[model samples]
Structure formats: C-alpha cells, structure tokens
Target: MNAVSAEPASAAASDLPAVHVVAAALVDADGRVLLAQRPDGKHLAGYWEFPGGKVEPGETPLQALRREIHEEIGVRVASAEPLIRIPWRYAAKRIVLDVYRVRAFDGVPHSCEGQPLKWVPASALDPSEMPEADHPVIHALVLPRHYLITPQPDADEDAFLARLDAALARGVRLVQLRAKASDDAALRRLAPACLSRVRAAGGQLLINSRSDLVDEFDLDGVHVTAAQLAALDARPVGAKRWFAASCHGPADLRRAQALGADFVVLGSVAQTASHPQQIPLGWSEFAALCDEAAVPVYALGGLVRDDLDAALAAGAQGIAGISAFW
Candidate 1:
C-alpha cells in the first residue's frame, strides 16, 4: 500500500501512470553479478537489469521469470520465489515491478538472441556509468552483513545482555534489536546497554524503525521496508551509508538501486518444511539471474553452507537466509 497521498502541486506530476513488471535476481559462481545490455531495438536499450521479463497474461510472477529466462537465455530455470516488488514510475511509463530469485535451472546460458553481457562485483558498479533505473539497487548491493538479534519478551536485562555478548563473540558485525513484544520504553532502556556491547565489539547497531536512532546512537545505518525502497526518490541520508530493504523482485531491485540500497535478501530457494507449496528454483536458473545482475547478489531461501559453492557459481556475492546464516 502506498503511503504518499498528497497530489503533486505541479502540473508536471500528473502526466503518467506507473508501469507494472516482474524481474529476476540471478547470480553465478565466483561472487560476480550478471548484467545484460538491452538489445538495440528494445526499450531501455543499452541498459541492464536482473534478467527475466514481464509477467505475461495469466501467468504468475515466478512463472514469468522462468519463461523469460529460458526464452531469452536458453537455460531452463528450476525453482524460484518472491524477492521484492518495486512499484515505480519511469520516464516513459509507470510500473509495478515484481522481482524473484531463480534458484536452479538446466543447461549453460547463451544469449539465444545476441546482447552484450558482463559479470561485475556488486561493489564495482557505478550508477553514473549506466542508466538511472538501477541506482538504488546499487546501494542495496553493498550492505554488509546485518544480523537481527532475537530477544524474548520475558528475558531480563542480564539475560538479554548475555545473548548480545554471545552474538558479538561470534563476530556478528551488525545487529538489529528486533523484539516487537518488548515495548519502545524497554528497547530505549536496553539500547544503551546493547550498543555499548556492540561498539566495544566493533560492531554497528541499528534500531529497526528509527532513523533518528541512527543519529542519536552514533550508529551505522537504517533498515527499511519495500514500501520505503519503492517510494524513495533519492537517498535521503548518507553516502557510504548502509540501508537494507526487504524486497520482492525486479521493480524492487530497480527501486532499491534507485534509492541506493546497501543490499537485499531474496527468497526461499528450495521447498522449506514451513512452506510446502512454495516450491523453489533449484540452481541453474539461479545462476542465470545472477548473470544479468550488476550489483552483488546473495542467494536467499532455504540456503545452507553447502549451497555456497553453487550459489557463488551462479554469481551471488554471498548467501543470505534465515536458516542459512546461523
């Protein structure tokens, strides 16, 4: 749901409607992202995107991602799921973009139709070097590891501190103190204690919902929602500033790039026990998606340490998963 309700005061604001689309976040081995130059005759020619295409009539977003990857690159995608959706307005059209992570597929990729292709590190892309559409995604591509510290509602301050210390000892570089059941007052009281530990351990801290906290705490960055990434016009804060987004797919990738996201987490790669119906895109397809990506991509969804080699081959900078990380 959109939060911006105010009409643009200028006549210039009402000229266009947003375009809706579906995109893929694919990667390959060796920690490099894939990028494809738009063919000479197509829209946004010479620009790049995470490979995949529009969701055709009657097909779901993942289905479209599968079809588009195969059709365009001649590889068969095996599994896939939601990454992020970015609803945006471009110069020529407005779009509601759905993006996905293609996990596995069959066959080596080749441009069935010729277009320029390159694999780059997520850390290397220069927004000024390309089209404007992927700017925010570039920022998102750089976010370092940020672990969410789980604190129970009933835990006492001492116990919470112990958990925080344990996490720091394990070399957690960043943290989000996400305890919803714990009230704001308690969190406030806990913040100083937690931050002291974090800083002593040489870690960065971020209060999940508070940008103000970033300033107040002398911390590193902010964690935002897909809505924030979608609505972002230009980065409102720092350069070399870290911002994380909960994304769904291409539109989200575009928005994240546009807003200058640090990095993003993409979906369940395999069928998890919790989601039997959420079938995953195995591996081949995942690599192809990475092939067209310009920013560092991580493999999310049902991932494990064992999947790292394959994911890297597919072009992800690293792996990101609820189950995979711990």
Candidate 2:
C-alpha cells in the first residue's frame, strides 16, 4: 500500500525461490472441513482457511503439514495425502499450494494465536465467507472425481456389464456413460440397459447428451459438450439428475459457471482422443482453466490412470476419460 510495503512487494514478487510447495489439509469430519481464521498482521488475515503453512527447503510437503499443524494448532497430523494443488499469485508472490486430505489426525485443533477455528460442513462452506485462494480448492474437493467409462459400439450387453462390474470392483463409484452409436434409435435403446448396469454396480452415471433421456430416465446426470456449454442458458438442472458440461477455454468455463453446472469436464490435458495433428493443452494451459472455474473441472482427453498424478499436479480435480478408467 505504502512506499515501504511497495519496496518489499517488488522484491518478493520478482525472484521468488523455487516455488515452495505449501501443504494444507481439508480435515473432514461428519461432512465438515476444519477451518482456521488467519490472525491479524498475517497475509490474507481475517479470511478463513484450512490450517497449513509453507514447506521449508529440503522438506516434503507432507512433513511440512505435520510440523505446521503441531506448531500452529498444537496437534500432530497423523496422516495426510494428496487432495489438490492450487497455483495462485498474490500481490507479493506466487505459491503452489499442495493440498491434502487429512482423514487421520490426533488431538483437537486450536490456533496458537487464539483465533477461532471451526468445522464447517461442506453444505455450509459458504463461498462468500471463504478466502479467495481457497474457492477452487473447495470445489475440487467436493466433486466425486468420477471415472469416465465409454461403451464400445456394437459391444454386447454382457461384455458392457462386465466392464461396469470390473470398474466398480476397482472402487469406481462414478462414471460417464458415452456410447457414440450412429443411429438415434440405437443410442436411445442402449440407455436403459446401460443405466441399469450403472445403478446395479452402485455407481452414478452421466449421459453426455439426450436431455430427453434425463427426463424419461432417472439417470444420475447429464454432461453437455463444449459447444452446448458456450450457448448455455440457466435451465432448470431439474430434480431428477445432476447437470454438468464440457469446457475447454475461459469462455466455456464461465458459461458453465453461469449455467450453475454441478461440475465440468476440461480436456486434452495430455493428448487424449488423438487425431495425430491435435496437440493437448498439457499442464500449464489446463491448470489456468481449472483455476478459472467455480465448480470442479475433471481433466479429460487422452488421460489414463497414470495421468491422475500429473492431472492433480496441474490443479485438476481429477482425471476423466473413456480410456483413463478402463
């Protein structure tokens, strides 16, 4: 703000050391994320966030989380693992926040500075009250991180069901049922059976098109293509199913956000749906798109199970693809 602060700001912003990985934990208990209010005089003070601190040089993010929790909250983080990464730039510097899910931890959390801490349920994680840097991280954490499953054209019902079962056995509880058959009648006829298999497997399904099917059948959701999202309207998400869409750039993401989409699929993060000539957005472009959205953006296109790590590294909610899950 003033000349003194401006000098330090210029210095901090310019030669930021190897982007330090800061670890944070969404400590959920009975559906709430544990939050600690930043004390006055600290960066982003007065804003509420998950308790965490910077990873010191030569230390791992997880180790930093454990030490920070103990130092700031007087509690040891028993265990923590990857949740998401948020690459954000403040007026002073850029930070690559490595978030983790702390499902196992000991002792009650308390702020050393005596600021209040509370467990706010996901349903109650009011956007207006959360710190700006945390908004995308919260969205990504709430999403199911679904695995996309596409049925092969002309594949038998039994074979399809087997794939469905295999996916479920591997702990996949969410899927997108995309069977690109040529005939309209065939796509229509295939819906009921496919929906049946998904429900039987105890997994939720999303149909890429056929809003009519969303009406006729009580499927889990609908995923609109990127084209559809661009010209999107604020239609009733309808009570029967969740509504989502596909997005690539900032425009598509903004449209989906305005349309009140539950989530969105963003893609070609790693050369998916290869046409040889088409190159993927890779990590940088993909992460920026993810940061722009208000809702979760699953990494799609050319993603396989192996790509999930890279996807998270790039700030995606998770990987989504016909090839990724299978």
Candidate 3:
C-alpha cells in the first residue's frame, strides 16, 4: 500500500482565503466509500475527492453536509457524524474541510453532475490519488478513535475473561490482548474465548507483537512494537487484518506510515507505572510529533477517558490506555 505524502507548504498557507467545506464518506454495507472525480474546468480537475461542496454562511457543518451531499450525489444524508476537521492549504487556496461519516441516508447515490463516481473499498483506496487535504480523511475513515491495551493476563481464566467482558461492555471497540507472560500454547488456549467475546460485542481484537498468533487463531489484527515495526520493509502478506504499530518518535511513525499501517500509538505521553524509568513525551512534544504524523495517532500511557479533549486538541485521534481503560 503506497501511502500518500503530505503536500509541501505553499505561500498560500499563510495568505490564502480559508474556504469552509463539508465532505462525506458515504460508506455502504460492504465497507466501501463513495469518491468523486473533479470535472473539467474546475480547480484540481481530474483529482478525486469525497463528495461535498462549500459551506454557506449561516449554516452549520451538518447542515452543509446534508445540503451538499444531496445536491452533489442526489442522496439525502439522513444521519451523519463528524469524522475529522482538516485545515489544509493548497497552492492557490486554503480550505478547512469538515468531513463526516454518512451512517444513514435516503436514495441511491447517482451523479447529479457529469462527474465520475466510484465506490472504493477502504483498504483498496489509493490515498495518493486524492487531494492532499483528504489524506487525513482517509486515515479517519480507516482508524477508530479509542484503543485499549489489556493488562497482564491472570492465570485464572475466569477472572481474566470477566475483566475482558467488562471492558468490552464499557465500549472498548478496538483492543490489544497483551499477554506477556503467556507462551504460544497458553496464548492459543486463551485466544478462542477472547475472540468469541470480542466478536460478540462487535469489537476488533489485535494480538500484541504476535503476527504468528494472529494467523494461528484468526484474530482480527496485529499490533507490532516499535522495534518490530522498524524491522519490517513491507506489510504482512497473509490474512488481511487491521495492522498498527507502537511508535515513539518521527522515525517510527514514518516507518509505520510507509508500511501502510492503519494507525499508530505514540506515547508515554504523561508517564506510566509500566515505564516509570522512561521520560514521558509531555503534551508539547506529543503535539509536535502528532502534527508530523500521517496516520491517526492514539496517545498512550498515563491517559484516561478524561484526557480525550486534551489528546484531540494535541492532534491525536484519541487516548489509548491499559490501566485507565480497564
């Protein structure tokens, strides 16, 4: 998967009029999103974009989405939610796109104009073909907001399963089953029940640092450590699942992005008991690294649900935690 590179900063970054726009990822039941190609004579002609148009004055972002989606695609957006707000600058103009996930709508999408349109699978999407402003939108569409890393698995199966159940009930949609003390056979024994519980809750489970286990048990994904991430030149070729990495700095983040990872976790943002000896990346440092990231980053270590606002403000997608999340 060739990732899209961020556009170079233009003179217009500081001087151009910032246009407000609303866009939609019209996702179908097949996990495919609708994309539109710019027609001739328009700015960025031949470039592909999510279907939407400029937001008019006195209209909320949702209102703009409803109106633009209906006009551009001929489908009435019945329900949509905020996905991401990107402040980007093209060579000629600056635009702030408030992108949404169109969860429910009325009418089949037909090209109201002569623009070409296609429904693309999320994984099959080529971000390089999209406008630079939409690079973050692609990340938002593929990655979830919250990431939960499990604590040390107890020897007692019932206690461990109970804890896992509680976390899922509390809305931990994406989880990493990190069982450091367990070996291949032991972890394999735990996998079936864990997989069942996660699937039942409509959640995705990624095994930590164990690509072999992911294949063996048919888990949803694999979360590689920073060291493991650096060692990889290409993405895993076997069963397709959500791939992520633990990144500590720009190099790790870049490598993960280049490897076509779905997302990355960057931290010890606030320090943690797990790595008390390591210096935490303070909010300022976290923000700086996150700004350079191409994928949606989750701030890990010393973060709780309460820190969600701070994390988002610092440019992180959300918070990831072990102790706090459980």
Candidate 4:
C-alpha cells in the first residue's frame, strides 16, 4: 500500500477533546498477531483493528490495556511492552492510541465482545483493512527497531561486502547504503552485491541515491536525503517499494508526509563524530518533534543499541547510525 499522509497532531487537533485509548498487538509464539474486526454499529465498523478500548479515569495506560483485553477478548495480559503511541484526529474527536506488544498473556484469546478474531503474521497485516491511526503500529510490528546506515564503502569491494555481511549477521534487518562520494558507476556495481547479501540474510536494503536505481538494482527502496526531500514535487518511488526520508525539522517532515514517505530519519539526537559541529536535539526536543510527525521516525546520530529504549520512549521507531552500526 502507498504511504498515506498522517493527520499531524497539531493545534487544530488539540482543540478537540482528547480521548485516551489503549490497544494491543497480541502476539503468539509463532509471531502472528491478533486482529479484531469492528462490529456493526461501531464508529469504524467493518474494519479490522488491534483490540482495545478507552481508558477510564485514573487508570494507567497499561492498566487500561490489561483491563480492556480481558473484557474484549477473554484473555488476561500477563505482560505487555510499549509499542507505539499514535495521536490521531477524526472529524469530531481526537484520540491517542497507546499500543502495546503483548506476548505473554493468560488463557486463549476468543471474542468476548462478539467480534471476529483472526491471527495473522505481522507482515500480512494490511494497512487498508485497519484504521489510519493503526498504520504506524503495523510498521512498528513489521520493521526492525534498529536501522543501519552504511558508512562509505572501502576502495576494496570485497572488504565492503564482508562488512555488510557481518552487520547483517548481527541481526540488522533494515539497512541504507549511503555512499555519497560514489559515482553512479560505482554504486551500480556495489548495490547488487549489497542487495544479494542483505536478501540472503532475509533483510532489505535501501539506496541513498536516485529512486530509479531502486528499480534498476532490484533493491528494496530509496532513502531520500534532506536536500532530495526539498527538491521533490511528488513521491519518488512506487507504493510497492519503501520510500523513506531524512528530516531535521517540521518543514521537512511535512514534505515527507506529503510525499507519502513510509518512515523518516530525524535528528542529530546526540552529538556524533560524523556531524560534531551540529547541536543535538536531546531526548526532550526529539520527543516534541516526534509529536508533530504522522509516520514512524527513527532517531538518528550517535546512537547505539543501548539507546533503543530511550528512542522508543521518545516515540521513535528506533535508532539509526553509521559508525555504531558498521
């Protein structure tokens, strides 16, 4: 499905009364997640969604999640981890969908509310069949928490391929090959080798160059640079391919959303050797900016695996980096 622009949680949405809701990506041991079809007469009836309900007064989001799960699906949540927080606006109401990944739950999940329940692999969850607010959740479920941006390739092609293989072996499921100095000829030669290795590892590779190369190289997608984001009048790639962008502020984000970018890499969240002169956004500022984003965002700059929890807490899809990843 093509990426759809998200309704930014801006001041206009704030004017509406906010409804706090909790939902779960109830995962089974086989990695399939549970989906509930909205019953007739409900607001979004006939669409499938992550099962959840409104949070009552004084209840923590987790509390509401467990309570709602039991009431709606006849299962007791033994443990749940924060997944994604989505701020969405409808015609008359605004809602914050506090979602969780529930892998440990008691009892089998059956429809307690007479709604139909289905278990499907995360990759099979269709965004069109779900609410717009749940779109990011699907991305979160399908994407890796860590995004790897390759450093410049060495003069020796085999050395570069070996390093790429090593990173893939380390469990990096998503990668961006960003060799700015390489010419098209060099990239054309290197991309296929990278793509073959990444695919063999069951991962996807995105090129940080012209979108056309994605089709030509048979790669997974294109990563739009901030400058490329500004120059674009429309989405550079097709809906079937991943389209990601790099953004530093609100304007770039708006452009990305308008261009239907699947996800975005934002910040200099922390000082890094690559861009030491630039100031870091810190976690607070990063969170503030994330509130304005409609799609999944990966925290960039000077981040490692240890920073994943902080990134997620700040509403990021995960963290991206060059050195730490390579």
Q: Largest TM-score belongs to which candidate?
A: 4
Residue-by-residue lDDT tens digits, candidate 2, 182-266: 3677677777777777777777877776576776777778877887676666643583356778877788877876676767788
Model 2 misplaced regions, further than 4 Å: 1-25, 28-32, 35-100, 110-139, 180-189, 239-241, 272-274
CA deviation > 4 Å runs, candidate 4: 1-14
Which order, best to worst by lDDT? 4, 3, 2, 1
lDDT score of residue 92 within candidate 4: 51
lDDT digits (tens) for residues 1-326 of candidate 4:
11123445556666987788889999999999999988777767778888888989999999999889999999999998887777666555677778899999999999987999999999888988887778778888888888999988868989988888889988998999998898778888999989989999999999996688899888899998999999999888887788999999889988997788889999989988867899999999999988878688999988888999999899888999877778
Screening candidate 2 with a backbone cut-off below 3 angstroms (N, C-alpha, C), the clashing residue pairs are 272-301, 272-302
Comparison by lDDT, 1 against 3, better one: 3
List the candidate 3 regions with Cα displacement exceeding 4 Å.
Answer: 1-23, 26-34, 38-48, 52-113, 116-139, 237-239
lDDT values for all models: 0.60, 0.69, 0.81, 0.86
Q: After superposition, how far is residue 207 of candidate 1 from its true place, in Å?
A: 6.2
Two-way TM-score contest, 1 vs 4, winner: 4
Model 2 CA lDDT for position 260: 67
**lDDT minimum window of 10 residues, candidate 3:** 1-10
* lDDT score, candidate 4: 0.86
* lDDT of candidate 1 over 1-326, digit per residue (tens): 11111221243433665444665556565556666677766655666766666666788766777788888777787776444444444334444555555546687677777876677777677655454545544544444433543444355788878877876787665676655567778867777787899889977776554565666666677666667667667764576556666555666766765566665545555667767887676676565555444445666676676776766566555565444433
lDDT of 3 by residue, 280-302 (tens): 99999998887666567889988
